[model samples]
Target chain A: MRNLHTDEIIKNIKEMCIEANYKLASDVEERVRGAYDQEATALGKQILGQLAENLDIASEDSIPICQDTGMAIIFIKLGQDVHIEGMDLEDAVNEGIRQGYEEGYLRKSVVGDPLIRINTKDNTPGIIHYEIVAGDRVEITVAPKGFGSENMSRVYMLKPSDGVEGVKRAVLETVKLAGPNACPPIVVGVGIGGSFEKCAVLSKKALTRSMDTSSPIEHIRELEDELLLEINQLGIGPGGFGGKVTALGVNIETYPTHIAGLPVAINICCHVNRHVSRVL
Target chain B: MDQYINTPLTMDKVKGLQAGDYVYITGTIYTARDAAHQRMYQAMEEGKEIPFDLKDSILYYLGPTPAREGQVIGSAGPTTSSRMDKYTPLLLDNGLKGMIGKGKRSKEVVESMVKNKAVYFAAVGGAGALLSKKIKASKVIAYDDLGTEAIRELYVEDFPVIVVIDSKGNNLYEIVLQSS
Candidate 1:
């Protein structure tokens, strides 16, 4: 078995955090560029132009794209053939986040307690998700999530009878409710067919997928396209000022579910949907 | 044409503004968000002095990242304004002329704006890097303990914003939503 050190993980995570904040993923950038060209309203176009300019400034100057550098979210695909050595994996990951936030001058938004609400200072204790694979290589993805859209996210526990129409209704309702709030020209990540919490996690995972990529599942792919058209038709526009391009892209992910339930979760993200991935 | 406005915005100036007007504001403004708002509201309730002047003042709902070396401030932009809805009416009642933030405010906050003759402005959310260049200077005025959420007095030059809700409670977001 190939051996991997936590130090390597720590180093990569730290750099990935900085890179994700400074430069948005290319897929997201491309979609925003495409949206800018297609947007109809003058106000919406101006807002989109400013957003594009903001992206340029962020990378050129080596500062974050948005001030809310967001909580660290890491997804790891660890190979079962690889053996990890050094500190506990979780602590090592948190160490990476601490160093990243400190060194990169990213905001420390985490609170130690829900009620007391004290800043953790170091931006530690990241939300990490792991999956074991067959190969010896490890793949890591970092997506720093801003809360403006996170607060607008929703989960629906529909009966089996609800079906695709129910899913459409739920997603449309969430987007309408989000309106100007989710930072329109938003990226919508949708998860379908799982337990409640599982679907929620899946929705967040969906946001990591490249905007140009569609789900491998045939029916799900069609659903993604249809939803994208329907959402833009809502005229939420860029910055929700009313125009044609409401969402940059819609990504849907699904898993097998229990016979009785059809759970759906919608995780919305702003124009600055910061995500970066690396493999080692 | 974008209206060029100077801060310390009065009721008369605010009244002249209309919903959907693009404005570039210069001069002085203060930053305060969740924690700072709570403290300031409690102080107002107890009849204690707030850190900054209340009359004709503008408060921006922002919580910026720490400045890097040689930088005036880090990527600074507007945060979600709806979160501050709880304390907004009180601030409006106390001679506040305008607020800078993103997203929708509550019905009560809008009503308070009508009564107090204040306007609510929104800078494009997530445009922090572009927005920071306009803030020529920034100094934390009070509540340093609140970290990023602290009250920072800022001198801005041509800060871009759109009037979302005007003094008479005319709303830009409402019209956009209806038309859509």
Candidate 2:
């Protein structure tokens, strides 16, 4: 069995949080630049230029890309053959979030209660998902999810006969409803075929995928391309003023489900879709 | 067309503006978001004094991140405006001449803008790092316990925005939707 120290996990998580907030991932930056070149409207081009400039400033000045540093969403792939020493895994992750938000000067957006909201102060208790995997190495991915777009996400439990067309309608409707509110040119993550909750989780996971990459499954990849084209055609544009680039990319993830149900979830992420990953 | 505007915007100045005009605003404005708005609306309901004077004032719906060492403010950008729709008409009626935010406002809020001769501006949301450069100074004026959600008085220089809704109830978002 491979033994891993808890401090290592905490240290990595802390670094991931700070770096993810301070710098836009290169793939995302590239996609934004590409969108800027392709955008037709004058206002859309100007907005995309400012977005590119913002990314540069954040990297150069070591400042956050957006005021809402977002609630930390951590995805962990734990090795079956590895054992953690000195702390509970979940506690270690939360400690990392607390330290990251405090030291990085990132915003503490978390509240203690849903109804009578009170600041959590240090942005603790990150949303963590775990999976047991085959190797001796652990892979950790951190995605800071801002609520502006998170609030726009939706799920539909479709009839077995509804099929692909239903999924398309649902995604378009969600994007249309989001309009300028969720920050266009957005990144759309669609999850299909799982149970309700599982589909939601899958949609979020799909968002962590790189914009430059496509789904390995050929049919699903085609669907992603088609959705991207239709969404951009909506002319939501950058900042939703009006243009040809409404979405930077459309990512779809799927799972096999019971024959009776066809579940789909859409998790919309803003242009500043910040995520970073590390393997140890 | 792009224009330069000064804060404490008057009805005359608001009337001169129209939907789709890009503007750079200078001078003082206040910041308030969900928690602060709720508190202010509650205070107004009870006939209590608000944290700042309302006449001819502009409010920006933002909750900026805390400043790091030497900076005047952290990434400051507009939050979604529709969330503030519930309390907006009250403020507009009380001589809040302008608001800075993004997204569509409620129909009632737009009507209130028309009735009160107010205006609504949209700052590019998620462009906080770029926007913060315009804020020359900032300090919390109320609800310090609310942290980022506190009401802040800010002195900004050439802060960029687009006129999304005008005094006549003309809406830029609707115009864009129709054209698209």
Candidate 3:
């Protein structure tokens, strides 16, 4: 059995928050750099070029790539054999977020209550997802998701007969509807074949999956490639100024579902899809 | 084409801009987002004098991150503008000459822009780090308690934007849709 202190978790989470905001994961960054050559439209190329410059500036000067540093979303894979010591797990995680936002100069985007709409002052109370894995290590992933694309995410409760074609149609329609609003040159995360809520979570997880990698499941891998091709053909382009590079990548995650339903969700993320992971 | 101009735009300047025209704006503009828009709209509704001058002014839909030590401002950039659509028409009617933000505006907002001879500008979304360099100065002018949503008076130099909707109501978004 492995013993871990909450202090260590707090320290790592704090650094992860700042790191995720400052830099795009390497797999994603490589695609963004290559996108300038792939983009067909002159204006689209220009937009992509600016995005590359923004990425450089963000890293070099220690500034966040986007003003909306986003609501903190953390996913942790806790080892069943490991014991944690210190504060409650949730508070330690939030304390990390609070320090990261304050010290890193990231935006405090959260409001304590939806209706009252007062700023939380410090960006805290992050959404954390925990999974118990068979190991002695605790893995944490920090993804600060911006709301522009978050607000555009959608889920469909498909009838069993809707099938793969229906899934494709739904994704296309959502991308078309999003147009420039989702901040094109997006990372499209698709979740298929799960319960409604499960699919939504899977979709968000899909964004964290490495862009250089594809699903191990053969059919899901094919779907990812096909959807990516179709989305880029969308003419949404970079900055939605019209071009052939509307999406940097399309990632799909699937799970078993009831025979009666084939639920699907699309969690759209802009080019600034910030996520960082660490193991302790 | 890139045209350089100052804010507190006049009718002639507004008319000169067309959909798809790129611009670099230098001078003063007021920043406000959802909350401040609501408050200003309510103030105008209540027949109270709004804090900033509306005539020929540009309302930038931005909620910037707080500046770090020795920095002018933290990652400043435009936010989604449609959320402010409900409060936009009244400001345009009173004398708002331009609005700077990203995404499509509502039909009513566009129509009001046409009626008031105003323009809508789109900045590249998520390009905050680069955009912040263009903002030379910033200070909260009103609603300081609203935090990031507070109204800020900003002095910008050669800040880039594209005219998405012109004074005559030609919208670049629709044009892109139709052409494709």
Off by over 4 Å in 3: none
Q: Candidate 1 on A169-216: residue-level lDDT in tens?
A: 999999999988888889999999889999999999999998879999
Each candidate's interface RMSD: 0.9, 0.8, 0.9
Deviation of model 2 at A6, angstroms: 1.1
- In terms of DockQ, which candidate is strongest? 2
In Å, residue A81's CA in model 1 sits off its true spot by: 1.3
Expressed between 0 and 1, the share of native interface contacts present in candidate 1 is: 0.77
lDDT of 2 by residue, A108-217 (tens): 99999889899999998799999999989999999999988998899999988988998999999999999989988899999998799999999999999999899999
Candidate 3: lDDT of B119? 95
Clashing pairs in 3: none
Each candidate structure's TM-score, on Cα atoms with residue i matched to residue i, is 0.99, 0.99, 0.99
Writing each residue's lDDT as its tens digit, candidate 2 over B1-180 gives 999998879777888899999999999999999999999999999999999999999999999988988999998888888999999999988989999998888889988998999999999988899999999999999999999999999999999999989999888877877899
lDDT of 3 by residue, A53-129 (tens): 99999899877899999999999999999999999999999999999999888889999899998888998789999
True interface contacts reproduced, per candidate:
0.77, 0.76, 0.70
Ranking by lDDT: 2, 3, 1
- In order, what lDDT does every prediction score? 0.91, 0.92, 0.91
